[model samples]
Target chain A: MNILIKITYDGTNFHGFQLQPDERTVEGELNKGLAKTLNKEVKIFYAGRTDRGVHALGQYANFYSDTTIDIGNLPKVINFNLPEDVSVVDAKYVPEDFHARYDARLKKYRYVVHLSRYRNALLLNKAYEYPYKVDPDRMRKALSYLIGEHDFNSFMGKGAVVKDSIRTIDKIDVIEEGDFLYLDFVAKSFLKNMIRIVTGTALEIGRGQREIEYMKEALKMKKRKAAGPTAPACGLYLVDVKY
Target chain B: MNILIKITYDGTNFHGFQLQPDERTVEGELNKGLAKTLNKEVKIFYAGRTDRGVHALGQYANFYSDTTIDIGNLPKVINFNLPEDVSVVDAKYVPEDFHARYDARLKKYRYVVHLSRYRNALLLNKAYEYPYKVDPDRMRKALSYLIGEHDFNSFMGKGAVVKDSIRTIDKIDVIEEGDFLYLDFVAKSFLKNMIRIVTGTALEIGRGQREIEYMKEALKMKKRKAAGPTAPACGLYLVDVKY
Candidate 1:
């Protein structure tokens, strides 16, 4: 039987989401947690691999197990065995053929920026600090150009070797709450460091370092150096993955 | 001229707020930043010292310098020279007699708790995570008993050696927003670990491990062991100091 699990974790303690042989990773920790709880070895497949120092709020994974454990108690037991920074929120039976990665329909990500002069210890890892005064109106205008389907090769990180860089952006929004500014994006899938690169370009525009027309040139250039610097990984979060 | 500067820092990167030999502290960094910007030596007096791993949002300090740098520009220049996690928010000229510590009126602190199954990587150094269900109503009831004047000897840490353990608590409030719970305390002064001890006791009451009556008993007992464990230092923040 296949089981679906919803999990959240602090990415700072692990190497990344993908499992590595000798290094600590989110997947390795999850497997260790499951093996302890189920008293058997388990192989799980995750929806996507997050980079080092990245976080997730509603990440999905699937595992195959011959024995049945009480689904309601899984969250409690997994949390009991896992470290303080990782937890299983929910567990449920899914279709035998269900795939966590292939079946995903859409994904949502949010990037947080703290615009205040003072730094917040609580937000140290969760938000990026942009000390310069940003023109929100100019950022909004630049964001308007990013909405819709486009070839995002210029925004892709050097490690991304995908053959096709075309992806549809469902929405792009800039919102300010108190001293925090959130940049929300929805897409079917993302290239490596795509969100961070987009954030960097937006910040450049907001700081009056670039113009909206530069985005068009960058997209057409299809070169990694044509865009702004990749924003820090601490400020990005995988908020949800729809399947 | 003498100036009082309101500063904020994310303490994860520093040893603490006090200056010590062979250690990276907030004061040491501040002095380095001021010296680089002002091109001379400077002395600063702080309202209080925070321990390692503790944070501050509104830490008060007074500095004396002979430079003609405008007070308004001090925050900008100091922040530009300082590290990303440390910042100067406000700088104002004050009388030479003004003292940051002795002349202070009130201080406010905030303890943040993330009560969720999943750990947030971004909030690892800023919030305490507890998987157990918390009864907010019960916590509120227990916190109310802590408001006003009382001898907080039981709530003080073992290292605290004060002539008097009595202090006045102006207000104590427990508020929940989204998945975060914050305990805000306003007081004229506090003994070491007083806030952490109070928070742990309140948490016990919320979890049904202790009753509200236990709070009264603990206060009367005036024994440190009678209270709950001291909450971790990472979750506490010096939020404001008003004079």
Candidate 2:
């Protein structure tokens, strides 16, 4: 039987969501925590892999288990064994054929930027600290170019192995709350380092370092060097994965 | 001439606010950054030292320099040269006798707790992750005992070296916003781990683990064991320093 879990985690302590040899990763910790709870080694599957220092709110995972432990107690058991930064928000039985990754229809991500003059100690790792004064209207104009499907070859990082660079972006919205700015993107799929690159390019436009039309040119050029630098991973969050 | 800087730093990557050997500390980083900017050795005077993983909003520091660098560009120069996690919010000239630590009249601190069933991946290191449900009204009632003047030795953590534990708490407020709980306290002075201990005790009362009146007894006892466990350092932030 397959068990699905709706989870959230602070990814700062882990290398990323994927398992790596001799390194602490979210999946490795989750597997260890599940094994301790069920008294058996279990392999878990994730909907997607978040990079190191990237967090998730509604991350989905699945694992096969034949143990008799009550599903209701799974959250408590896993939370007790897991570190304070990782938590299983909910767990339930799923069909054996249910897939966490390939079956997903859409994914939503949010990147937060603290725009205030003062740096918040409490928000250090969770938010991108950009003290530069920004023009939101200019940023919004740059974001409009990213709302539809594009080749995205210009935004791809150097080490990405994926051959297909075409992806669709459902929507891209930039909203401000008090001193913080939130950039939300909904998409069926994203190229490697795509969101970070988009954010960096948009920030440059907002800072008056680049024009909004640069985004259109970058997409048409389909060259990696045409886009801005990739933003840091700390400010990004995997908000939700819909199936 | 001496330049006093009222700065804010996100301490996520720092050992603490104090200078320490063989560690990436806020003071050490600030000193190095200042030296790099001014092309001379610089020493900074801080209001107080913060623990590892702790944050500061209005931390004050002062440095002496003979260079005629424009004061108007100090923030830009220091910010451009400093690490991304550290920033200079404001800078000004101060009298020779104006001390960052000794001349401060009051300090304000805030501790944040996440009370929702769903953990916030972005706030993992910035706030306390409490899975149990909390009663805000009960927590507020318990905090009333901490207001006004009191001998807060009971709330001081073990290994605190202080000759006197008497302190005047100007105000203590418990605020609930969505699933987040914030405890704000203003005091003339605090003993070691005083705020954390108070927050832990208030959490105990809020969770129905203890009675509110127990706080009164704990204050009178002047014993560290009488209070609740010290809350983690990650959730605490020094918000302001008044002169």
- Evaluate all candidate structures by whole-model CA lDDT and list the values in order: 0.86, 0.85
What tens-digit string does per-residue lDDT give for candidate 1 at B1-243? 888988888888788899999999999999999999999878888888887888999999998888788776778888778887788888998898998998889999999998976555446678887767899999988888778888989999987768999999999889999888999999988899899899999888888999978888888888898888888888999998988
As a whole number from 0 to 100, the lDDT of residue B27 in candidate 1 is 95
Question: Quality of candidate 2's docking, in CAPRI categories?
Answer: acceptable
Interface RMSD for model 2 amounts to 3.7
What ranges in model 2 sit over 4 Å off? A9-16, A19-25, A28-43, A79-87, A114-131, A149-153, A156-166, A220-226, B8-43, B51-53, B72-87, B116-125, B158-163, B221-226
Q: Could you tell me which 10 consecutive residues in candidate 1 chain A have the lowest summed lDDT? A: A116-125
lDDT string for model 2 (B1-243, tens) is 878887777777788888888999989888888998899888888888888888887788887887677787787788777787777878888888788888889999999898865555556567898878888899888889888988998988777677888988999888889778999989878888899999999999999999988888899898999999989887998888898
The TM-score measured for candidate 1 stands at 0.85
What range of 10 consecutive residues in model 2 chain A has the weakest lDDT sum? A116-125
Candidate 2 lDDT by residue in tens digits, A1-243: 799998888877889888999999899888889999889998788888888988888899998998787888778778788887888888899889998988889999999999966555456578888878899899998888877878999998788888689989999889999888899999977877889999999999999999889988988899999999898888999999988
